[model samples]
Target chain A: MAFASALKCRECGREYPTDPLNVCEFCFGPLEVAYDYEAISRAISRERIQNGPLTMWRYQDLLPVDGDHAVDLQTGFTPLMKAPNLGRLLGLDHLYIKNDAVNPTNSFKDRVVSVASTKALEYEFKTLACASTGNLAGSVAAHAARAGMNAYIFIPADLERGKVVGAAIYGPTLVAINGSYDDVNRLCSELADTYPWAFVNINMRPYYAEGSKTLGYEVAEQLGWQAPAHCIVPSASGSMFTKIWKGLKEFEDLELIPKVHTHMHMTQAAGCAPIAEAYEAGVTRVRPVKPNSIAKSLAIGNPADGYYSLKTIQESDGDATIVPEDEVVAGIQMLAENEGIFTETAGGVVISGLKRLVERGAIKRDEVTVAYITGNGLKTLEAVEDTVRSVTIDPTTSSFEEQVLNA
Target chain B: MGVTVRIPAPLRRVTNDQDRVEVDAENLADMVDAMEEQFPGIKERLIDETGSLRHFVNIYVNGEDVQFLQGLETAIKASDEVSIVPAVAGG
Candidate 1:
C-alpha cells in the first residue's frame, strides 16, 4: 500500500524515478518522495488510520516501503500532552507538548532512522551509515543492528560522552572527527561518493526525512484531525520544521484534516542560530556560525534546510527566535517542573522560545499551541547539571531524617 | 554594484576562513561569478557539476533567497549583501 510515485526535487520541480538518491541530477536540489496522493486518499480514511497500529506505521499507506519487514522499534505515536500547567506558567491557555523524548533512543531521530534503515533493508543495502551530531548516531546504530546491516557512523569528537557510549554500545563502527558536525558531514558526503554503503542522511534521506511528517500527522490527529493555531519546533538542519509543515499540508490535501491556520515557529540556541538570525533581519539567507552553546544537539551552525525552514516560517506568517544558553537550561528545568517532561537542551531551546513568543505577544494565550520536545534530558544532563539542583543526603537514619525534615 | 557576501563556516575552507567577502555585481549570478574569481575553488564547493547550486547550499541577497527571486538572476544593489550558507548537519 505504499503509494510512492517519484522523487521530486524540492528546489526545482524536476521529478526522478524512485531510487536511493536525494539530490536532483539536473538542478542539484534536494529530492523528496512524491506519492499517488489521490490513490492513497481514496483508500485511507480517519477510521482506517485510527484502527491501525499506535506507531508511525499507522500511515504506512503514505510511507515509502511495503511488507511487514519494517525497521520498526516502536518509534512513533508518542504522547501529545495537554500542558495546562506548562501553559499557565507560560501565560498561555491552550498548549500541547509533543513529547518525543521517550523514543527508543530518547530522541525523535528514532522516527527518521527507523524508516531510513527499513528502506535501506528493502533496498538490500549491506551497510548503514550517516553523518550525525549525536542522536542520529545512536538511532542509526541501533536500527542498523536490528536490520543486520553493517553500521558505520561518524560524529564530531567532542560529542557528549553519554551519546558516544549510547551509540558505541550498539556495536557500530563509529568514527570521531575532530571538528564541527559540518566537517564530519562533508567527509561523509565524500565517503558516500566512494563507498557502496547506504548513507542515511545522504542517499536514503528522502525516505528518512519523511518519517518526521508522522509527528505532524500525529499532532493533528491527536487534536481531532485539526491543525493547531501555532507550533514551535527546535531546528538543527531545519528538516523537522519543514517536514512538520508538509505533514500538516498533506493531511489537509487528503481531507483527513480541515484547512486550518497553523503558524510554524522555529527555535534555536542563540549561540548557533543562523536561521533565526536570518529571519529576524527579514533575510532569507542563513549565515553559518561556529556553534558554542551547551545545546550541542541544536548546534548546527550550517543548517542544510535553513532556507526552506526560514521560507516555511515566513510563508506561514510565523517567526524564529533564538534563546540564550542560560534560558535554554532554565527552559529544560521549567518543563520538568511544570509538566514532568525531562527534555534535552534542544527541547529547552524550544520551551524558552515558546515563552519568548508568548511574551512578545506573537502567540496568543487562547490559541492552540504545540511545543515540540524532541529529545530526552538524560543524554544532556551534563549541560544542565551545574544549573539544576541536586538533593544531598546522608546515609545515616538520623541524618536522613534531619535532611528530610529541614524547615 | 558592490555587495558584501558572508561566507558560511563549512565553506570557509575554500575562502580561507574569511567570514565575509566583498564583490561587485549587478545580479546574483554576477556576484557568484565575482566570488569565483576572487576565491578559487569555492564555486565547486557551492555548486554541483551540473552548474546548479548544491542542495546543501543556499544564497541570499539582501535577506531574500535568490531561488525565490530569479535564483541567480536576482538583482543586487551596491548596498545589498549576499550570503552563502550551507546546511549544518550537527544536531
Candidate 2:
C-alpha cells in the first residue's frame, strides 16, 4: 500500500488527493506528497530495511510509490567513504565523502530520476520528459529507456558533449535549447502546460525530489545509523541540501537514529552564488544572478530552493560559502590527488568551499564532516583541462618512462 | 512592499505564467503574503506553511536577496523589483 497521505501545498496548507499534479490549482503553489508518517514509522524497521534491496527502493515504505512500477536503475546505496587522506591533507581529523560519482549516470540526479520515472509509470504515462542541465537529462533518458517509455529530454545547447551523447544514446528525443538552463526550463514549463508528457521536475516534482532523501539515508546508514556532525553539500537549486536535511530528520523521527545534529553547509561557485551571497549578507531571500561558472551543473542563477538552503545552514549552525574559479579548480585537483576521486566542477566548488569554511573557522576541523561529491569529473573535463597536464610520448618503454613517469 | 515581481516558468502556473506581477508589500514576507493572496497557493510553493520559504524557491527584491537584508522582514519600496527563481538543474 502506498503510504502517501495526500498532496499538500507547501504555502497555503491546502491538501489534495494524490495525483500527477505538481502545482496547486487554487494557489499556484508547488505540491508535495504528504505521508501517513505514523504508519510508515510503525512499518519501517531497521531489520526490515536491511533485508530489502540494496538500492534506494529499500525504503519503499517511506517512498511515494505503491506497486512494482518503481522505475529502478539500481540507483543509491552508494559509498560513504572515510576520507582519511583527504582530511589529513586539509588538516582535518574526521571527514567523509558521499561519492555519488559512481551512480549510473555518474551523478546524484539518478536518484531523483529513478523515483520520477517510477511515478510516471505509476501514473500510466507512456512518455517521460524533463528540463535538465546535463545530469538529469542523461538520468531521465536512461531510466525512461529502462522503463520502456519514450523519452523527450530538453537541455541547454552548450552542455558538455559527453552528457549530450549520453542522453542521446538512450534513444530519447533530445532537444537543445539555445539559452541557459533557465530558458530550457521556461520552455519546458510551457510544454508541461500543453503536453501530457511527464516532465519529472515539473508535474512529478514531489516524487522526483524524494529521491534525494535517499542520499541522506544512505549516508546515515553507511555511518552505522548515525548522522554526521556536519555535511557540506554543493547547492545549485538548493534542493539537495534541504532534502539531505529532511532525510536525516525523517530518520530521527523514525527512531532509526538519535536526534540529528548534522549542520548542513551550502557551497557554490563564486561566479553564480546567489544563495551564498544571501547567506553572507545575513539574508533569507536570494536574488537571481546570471551564472558564469565552470561548474555549470551547480549554476542555477536563480535557485528555486536558495532560501531553504540558507535557512538550513543557519539553523544548523552551518555556513555557506562560494569558491572562486581558480579555487574551484584547485579543489578539484586536491580531491583527485588526495582521494583518487575525479569530481566535476560542482565538487570543486564544494571542496573549495569546505576549505574556505575551515579557514574561516566556521567548520571545526575535528568535527565529523561529510563532503558530498555529486558528479564525476569526466562530465566537466573542460573545467580542469587547463590544469590537467598531458604528456605525449612514443609507444616505447623508455620514452613512456622518461616523458610521463619521470616527468 | 509595492514592487513588481517576476515569476519564472516553473512557477508560471501559480502566477498564470505571467512574467511579472505588481504587488504591495514592505518586505519579502509581505510580498509573499501579497503574492499568495493574489495568486493563492503560490506562497506555499515559495514558502512553507510555517511561513518559511521553500528550499527550492528563491525570492529576490530589487536583485537583492532578502536573506542578506532582513530575511522575511526585509523592507521593500515601490521602486524595488522582485523576481522568483527556482533552481533549474537540467543542463
Maximum-DockQ candidate: 2
Q: Judged by lDDT against the true structure, how good is candidate 2?
A: 0.82
Candidate 1 docking category? Answer: incorrect
Query: What tens-digit string does per-residue lDDT give for candidate 2 at A294-318?
Result: 8888877777667667778877888
DockQ, cand. 1: 0.17
Query: What is the lDDT for B85 in model 1?
Result: 49
**Model 2: residues with Cα > 4 Å off, grouped in runs:** A397-407, B1-91
Weakest 10 consecutive residues of candidate 1 chain B by summed lDDT:
B82-91
Off by over 4 Å in 1: A391-394, B1-91
Candidate 2 lDDT at B50 equals 77
The sequence of per-residue lDDT tens digits that candidate 1 reaches over residues A257-284 is 9895899999998888989999989887
